[model samples]
Target: IQKLAGGDICKGRIDVYPKTRENIQVALRVSRVNQLLGADFSAEQIKEIISRLGLKVEAAIKGGTLQIEIPGFRPDLTREVDVIEEIARVDGFDKVDTIFPVASVRPVRIALRQTMLRKIREVLCHTGFSETVHFSFVECEQAENYLSSFASTEDKVISLKNPLSSENDTMRTSLIPGLLKTIQNNLSKGQKPLKLFEIGSVYFIDSQGKRVQKTVLTAAVLGPYELTPWKPRGKEYDFYDLKGALDNLCSHFGLQVGFPANANRSYLLEEKSANCYVDANELGYIGQLSPDKTEIAEKVFVWELDLQKLEKSLPPRPHFQNIAKFPETYRDISILVDRQVTSQKASDLILKAGQPLLKRVELYDHFEGKKIQSDKKSLTFALSFQSKDKTLSDDEVSPLFETIVQTLKTELDASLRE
Candidate 1:
């Protein structure tokens, strides 16, 4: 109805909309015979040529040549070539020369952004993650419920006014819900130890009252990642296992990954989840899928990342350095701190104090046993110290390591675990 009201009469092409007037009008300046056909001719010759095309020739132009108004029905009459073609139609096509067009091909380099994304997908696939794809359109209930963590009130979901079915009536707000359903279906089919991924779009409204979409990469793991022989004991897939996959992905592109300073307070996690970021943008969240959100009996660890944001955050040029020639001095220690104190805090302090020679800090173990305080947790880290020019000795590595341990003790009330 809107198309008809707007005067779209052509089947595929949009017809001229005569909103301001009852009919569309166009002016066509009749060029000289020399300009039109590359041949000199008199006014009468031009008029005679136009008269042959059934157009009424009017007064002369500034150079004393014929100019006339083109009819609305003749939409093709706008420029000199158009007029020349009409003249040619009355003239002879046999006289015009025809030439075949030439074709050329050149190889082009792939864009860095696209190359980065391709490498990401390849890395994930190589890490035993099978890619899954699904319909972009989804149920309204799905869209409203599985909104992205970064969504705001303006990020309204888009729903088709006329839909094929309720199952696919609206655009998805995130990919996790679909991925969860995929996991569920796989489990029902007796497929366990599943690791799946998807790269797709999530649709939402922008602040300017327009619909927008963001591309994301989402992955999920269920059951055990490795099949073990029938045994009484075997640990299932955990959050770190999924995180390790993601960490491995970021490392491929030289992308930096970080987590919030505090445990997520916005239901990101009560304990097991942490929001991941690249260059301060909340790319996505990696956490355990809550039971309420799924019927799958086994635990599921999921990671959702914004590949578009990841592309934007990639450095223009990646830095490369040779491995340190001197062997690294290693230190492993366990510190007891309040449960609320994040491991990131301790790691940052270790990096800060060990700035001159501290090579790397890694959390190797975490424990909250019966012997430990109820309100506190035991965190273990592996610290590596190295010097570019000389070997780092125990005398040099110990004091730097001890200074960081003391900083943790003073700053977070952390104590070295016996």
Candidate 2:
């Protein structure tokens, strides 16, 4: 028991016995109902509306006024305004006047990443590569050997419990393995040297012990893939061919990309692989398919990019640079480097050699045939030199070019091609 405030009497709680209860009455006025609802209803109409409600309600008009006895069952009809609502509802809500609201800005859901993905596909297709798609599920044993973990962990793959078959027992951790399968399927159907690309998700576990996934862009070219039909000089798709397409893609998006010197990967052949990066974040890697992982009787080069990382690298706004209005000087320099050195390494060294004024460095041709030394290959690059402030002459630019060649000579033991 608790004492009452400033009183001698005390109050105590008790469990009360339950019993059946009687109905309570509520009064409603017709004029008050009309004033609140803005719905002028006749007394006869009110009676008819109540009658239509299927209740035996005793409703009538007496002495130039309307009367309605609220039903004890309708707890909502405790107020006269509620009585107005009932009449309006039974009559039809269309009777109420309609009003137009002032228009405001509406949102059209435009996914930027998805839009960019479509553009990437468009660029590749325009570059003579057809887009292809594959199942996220793959053979577990096959995927285990080609796993590329997003997070630095060994136990990163996600396997399915009720997979349709052993082939679909594991979710894909890399796109290259599935892409290789696609290539094999195409080859079996008499389609050789095909250029193909895929944009899809690769699933794995993150560092937080949760399922994580990322969208990746993977491309492959197998056999004697040719963009030009010049039959006299049938060209096979090489590392630089795929690299050229990717470079176009990066230029289209206005992104500055970097390829690392070394990418010793399981699925790629030695001396033919490099990891791509934007800023400090590793985007993905590109290389020739290792012969051991493939049974197809052709040369295959594949590239994959973690588009999730690329998406994050997008700038919120664009930056504009004035095109060099002065006449540019183009230099064709072919350097013969060791067989073990990759074009990307030589390119990096070239960029490092040509500092501020080296506007562009593009590879036009690469050869590794009989005329070239047994242990050396030739790479031809078109170096463009220009300045915003002045027209660069060969006399002024030769020193810098010589410096680049000298650096290559000292660092890579490179020599100018005869």
Candidate 3:
């Protein structure tokens, strides 16, 4: 091997029989030195040491073991330790230590906000709602059409550079679009009266033209409000169903939710279709889909809440109280008013007027006819009155009732029916 590797002494031949023992001793010493240094010993280094004695050495591999083929001129092949050192060096650094320290273990604590969100989901589920998960990415066209205020150019959107499809190119700016798409998909699959909700993140452009991520809880319900075997018997979902759902959610969270009359209009709904509110500073909206947009999803109603605001507003846990023990007083009042005036306005007027004694106001009847003035309609409202600390006599409730009626007349130009 030394001769083939270009070593000088291995170029010539000589007798090695006379000095066999001395050659073996020299080989053992060379192997010890190589092992201590832990370096790969080149054939040139070995041949240089043996050349002074006019000997030749050659390396050979046979039967998976390295052997020294001693030429008659090289006598350094007589030791086993030399072969062992050569094998160890050629095998590389597999013997090095690589063990590391063990990591510490600890229990993970769930966030209070996340726990509240889970509770909300459970409450909805118990109320016959199913949880849904929707993709954040949606079509640019759908986002533009469904969302109230979205960034104009698709390039300004946080869009996928390599989108799977044109329909999934831009990140969703609002949950309504995705929820409607979900309804459309289920409708195609023959599913009806679907009550579904999703709690997840949505992307939008902020005032500074930066993409912002906001967590939101949104729900959509469509088809008949009540299922029935008889054809054309059930009531389709409408604004009232959505209002009830919102009221239930607010009650579950111990939040005070109120809908003031003449609230802002949503892009998705008409004047009679939508209502918006500030639930203790958190804003929310519920409404029927606008007729044109309803073509994408028939008879659907939806609502959305800002989850960050909701988290700030939600109670940490639920509390319970016993029902009122005292007898409750009830009163009914009817107002003949302009058809342009919304039920919400009348309800608001009654509530504001009733003040301390009023427990609730509900509109139960509405009438419109030629006998009724063309510009006027009649609305009947039920009012419940109760005092928390004491049972009230008829006289005690009478004055407050009169005051409420007078206030309605003064504020809303409402007149009591004869």
lDDT of 1 by residue, 288-351 (tens): 8667666667888787877777888878888989987889888897999999888877888888
Model 3 per-residue lDDT tens digits across residues 296-383: 6477777877777777776667788889888789999988888778887888878877778788998778788887889889999999
Clash totals for all models, in order?
0, 0, 3
Which residue pairs clash within candidate 2?
none
Clashing pairs in 3: 1-58, 56-73, 56-74
What is the alpha-carbon lDDT for the whole of candidate 1?
0.77
Ranking by lDDT: 2, 1, 3
Which 10 residues in a row give candidate 2 its minimum summed lDDT?
19-28
How should the candidates be ordered by TM-score, best one leading?
A: 2, 1, 3
lDDT scores in order? 0.77, 0.78, 0.69
Return the top candidate by TM-score. 2
For model 2, how does the per-residue alpha-carbon lDDT over 100-156 read when each residue is reduced to its tens digit?
555888898789887788889889999889888789998887667767534454546
Worst 10-residue stretch by lDDT in candidate 3? Answer: 60-69
Query: Which consecutive 10 residues in model 1 have the weakest lDDT in total?
Result: 20-29
Candidate 3, residue 310: Cα displacement in angstroms equals 1.0
Question: In the order shown, what is each candidate's alpha-carbon RMSD?
Answer: 12.2, 11.2, 13.1
Total residue pair clashes for candidate 2: 0
